[model samples]
Target: MSRSKTDKPSALVATRPDPFRAAFQQTVELLIQRRADLLSETAINAYVDCDWLTWRGGSLKLTTTGENICAQLRNKARLHARA
Candidate 1:
């Protein structure tokens, strides 16, 4: 028997690990840590473009999405450390 599209896994789901996951995580960590010197202009631009971050009074600020990402990353880090 064949399954319908809804019954099967969504095509949007990734079958393999994202190669850039670690780099992206590190970038997010740097953003959360407010490590300006560690961040590239391209990375900052990408974050701004994605609405993950914003500029306020010449300083970068985290949007709600960025806050959530930081929280999730921190939680994962804590969990990994415990493991």
Candidate 2:
């Protein structure tokens, strides 16, 4: 059937934010702030899979790569806000 001009888009067809990116950012923030206890399973897995996080002794820690990524994320966020 032909659609009408005023018809609203279906909710199922709506674009959503990337879940992985959201989780990754949350993970990075928590790790950088030393709040690992607040991290979710998805966040931990995403960071570990990207090699941005690591286990040190009995605690979760950010690798050097993780630190660099966090810095980049911060810079990007700042730029986006300015825009």
Candidate 3:
């Protein structure tokens, strides 16, 4: 019922971000940047599953949600770079 002195405060125990997810998002960002070499059948399917991409005229296209996500990623990158 009481907090232990050995226990770390939640604020001090920051969770590290997942590198794989970050890498995947960077891949998606590349796709948005028209890096055709990065988009494969499996990658397309994965993006589609997340509703961040769609098939349009037999070509992969970003959905509205995808655009928003890409924008957020770009902003975050910019902020991180500034920092």
Candidate 4:
């Protein structure tokens, strides 16, 4: 068997990370497990710590910081893939 320089070896390719997704999933699981109404005040407080946490909403209703944090985390993840 032979390989060419134009064909990248599988080992050389980096995988993308999805911590934000993991966090989001954990949060949702907590929401369900605790039976906390999504509208409950305590749930809101608990979820807000993620900084860029967002719920489904219109443009103005989205959590700006939460969205920003997720974007940055994803971008940083991409940077890591480049390394």
- Evaluated at residue 67, the lDDT of candidate 3 is 74
> Please, what are the lDDT tens digits per residue for candidate 3 over residues 1-83?
88565443322222323452355576766766878576676766655665667779876777786676667667888999999
Per residue, candidate 1 scores C-alpha lDDT tens digits across 1-83 of 89666443222222313433335577766756878678889877766655666889888887786676567667888999999
Sort order, lDDT high to low: 2, 1, 3, 4
The order of the candidates by TM-score, greatest first, is 2, 3, 1, 4
How accurate locally, in lDDT, is each candidate? 0.64, 0.65, 0.62, 0.46
* Per-residue lDDT of 53 in model 1: 69
Encode model 4's per-residue lDDT on 1-83: one tens digit a residue.
Answer: 67665333222212223643446444554545754354455535434533333445421122565455456666877898999
Instruction: List, in order, the clash count of every candidate structure.
Output: 0, 0, 0, 3
Tens digits of per-residue lDDT, candidate 2, 1-83, equal 88664333222112323464445677766777888889887767656655667788977887776676667667878999999
User: Which of the two candidates, 1 or 3, achieves a greater TM-score against the reference?
Assistant: 3
Q: What are the models' TM-scores?
A: 0.56, 0.59, 0.58, 0.36
* Stretches > 4 Å off in candidate 2: 1-19, 32-34
Stretches of candidate 4 exceeding 4 Å from the true structure: 1-44, 49-51, 54-62
Return the TM-score for candidate 2, rounded to 2 decimals: 0.59
Model 3 has an lDDT value of 0.62
**lDDT score for residue 11 of model 1:** 22
- Candidate 2: deviation at residue 37, Å? 3.2
